[model samples]
Target: MPRLIWPLLAALLLGACASKPEESPERTEAAQYREAQSAMDANNYLTAIDRLKELEARFPYGRYAEQAQLDLIYAHFRSQEYPETVVAAQRFMRSYPAHPSLDYALYMRGLANFYMERSFFDSFMTTDKSARDLTSATDAFEDFERLVTRFPDSDYAPDARTRMVFIRNEMARHELHVARYYARRGAYIAAINRAQYVVQHYQRTPLVPEALAVMTAGYERLDQPELAAKSRRVLQENYPDSEYLDDDGQVDLAWWPREGKGLMSLLTFDLL
Candidate 1:
């Protein structure tokens, strides 16, 4: 029994010695970052995401951790996984509010929502979708505005500002589209409401002319000749060259009124 005990003890000691020591966490983190960078370079975003997440979870305490989280955002965005991009960007912003890379996080957050707001329906819908929900587009615009406000000197600011213009146009167009739809359906009051909203809230937008035109059309439909004339007066004053206006700079009563059928009217997008 004593001999057997000695052999068992020896075997246990040898097994312990043969087992590999735990690798240093710092080294592992560095390796993970390298791998992620390599994958990103190769455009293998999913692989980069896996390595970046692992690095972030294991080492949330230094520059490497911050880089990991930021890399995760780029990986998700490059992969066209927009929801994940938004989540990661928000998380980075929350965790590192004063991080030097905050501008990047904000820009990416806006970019994610920007893509989410884009859809084939918006581009090719038969009817204008002013009444359609524009929550995502509005959200993206806010994000961009915040980024521009907070980090005006950031390299991303110029692009963010440009995108803000696009978002503004989309929103204003949405309102004008709804107003036109309401006018077409003989819902003059609703048409006036939406058109008025665009003119008041979204001034300077390219859609302003369209909104004023809708207001004029709506008032005309409601048999309020005075109000209709007032709307036309505003439209002509602001947009003398507007296609919606006649040679006399009056709101064109001939165009939209001519199309009287089951088919929906289409609008050409002129956003910059």
Candidate 2:
């Protein structure tokens, strides 16, 4: 009789263990977040995205929702799905403008645009110059500028500042390239306008010296000696050691600086 009672007790204990209560959605969401974070740390971006999305849907208004959204953005970024990342970041910014992660959201938005703009060079080399992606890049630059201005003490501000410089330089380079195309075809007036646009819009960019050089050369070729000399004086005053000079004491007609490497005298331009 004692042996039979022991067997029955063991069976009861096993049934009780199997009948334990299911975890609440909150607890499940927490578990998912932890697992997704582990996956992200392992660089398993796709898995992390899936898990994070599930968490978001399962706890839409819960405490983990915001973190899930932020992680989703990071996952898209890691996967190089920049458009998706941008969309997620924009949504986060709109939905949680006052959240403590607002600065990070803004920075991610800018970074997405920065990467999207990189493809512009490929488009520019094609015949469809109008298809270039400068609009997105311009928007990004503005967003980053806003972030830096509004959240100066944010941890992302320094990165935003650096990206702003890169954007300015790229914009200036694009303008300089267009100016050169016009100048080579004897469109000196058009070239001058474009070069001046670069000087006016992207004065702090590394390409400013090359843009000034183009203006000087364009003015000279158009037989506007006074304007040519004036442009040269501006270049010399602003960039005394510019490498854009030619052997004939004139600025090179078709030269532009490498994208990020400015002339040593760029700091003296007083544009910043």
Could you say which candidate leads in TM-score?
Answer: 1
Instruction: Summarize candidate 2's per-residue lDDT along 222-246 as a digit string, tens digits.
Output: 7899998998989888988788875
Q: Which ranges of candidate 2 are over 4 A from the true structure?
A: 1-27, 119-132, 246-248, 254-272
- Residue 244 of model 1, lDDT score: 90
lDDT of 1 by residue, 136-209 (tens): 77889999999989899999999999999978888888877777666666677998999899999999788888
Reference-based lDDT, each prediction: 0.83, 0.82
lDDT computed for candidate 1:
0.83
Worst lDDT run of 10 residues, candidate 1, spans 263-272
TM-score (C-alpha, index-matched) for candidate 1: 0.79
